[model samples]
Target: MHRSKGIVIGFWVVTALLCLQMGFTAYAQLSMPEVAEAIAQLGFPHYFRKELAWAKLLGVVLLLAPVPARLKEWAYAGFAYTLVSALIAHLAMGHGPESWIYAVVTGVLWGLSYFFWRRLQAPSVGLRPATA
Candidate 1:
């Protein structure tokens, strides 16, 4: 039981950090002129930023709300894809580590959140201690 509690704590903490990163980036996409310029420079249409921001907001809602497991799974997959795409785009554009470092760090956070979430879902899986 104590282990389960610890896992729960770890899950929420990591998930919260992931959500904060996504939320901040989404806000940046929506309001930051530099972000707009960067995307446009990358050949994205002007409307992409707003559309991505709304999608991220919806993803955040699904992640935080007590929605169905299927919805949460979709949110997780969306975030994973978003992070990977951002990293790839930054690299492909010849941007240095400064540009893509946050995505790498957040990717780790996302991995942790997914790990703990799966553990929580099947707490009786192989992680459980054998009783005396």
Candidate 2:
């Protein structure tokens, strides 16, 4: 029971961290001039920034709300994909290896959150088999 509680707490902590990162990212994407300039420098259309910001906000909500499990799973998958793509984009833009840190850190957070979430859904490790 203690272990299960630990896992639940760990899951929420990691999920909160991921949500915080995504929330800030979405806000920056929507409102920051620097973010717009960076996206534009990457050859993306000006409208893509707003679109991605909205998508990220929605994804964060899906992860946090009492939504269906399948939807939550998609949110996790979407975040994973977004981070990986960001890493690739940075590399493609000729950014040095150091520029990958933000994406890498966020990716790890996402991974841990997803891992704990899956573990929480499994049968408790402390449970014992019933005897006849």
The RMSD of every model to the true structure, in order and in angstroms, is 3.3, 2.0
Candidate 2 lowest-lDDT run of ten: 120-129
Q: Score each candidate by Cα lDDT.
A: 0.89, 0.89
Per-residue lDDT of 14-118 in model 1, one digit per residue for the tens? 999989999998999999999999988777799998998888889889988999989999999998998898899899899999999998999999899999987
Residue 48 in candidate 1 has what lDDT?
90
Residue runs of model 1 more than 4 Å from their true location after superposition: 1-3, 123-132
Please give me the total number of clashing residue pairs in predicted model 1: 0
TM-score of each: 0.89, 0.89
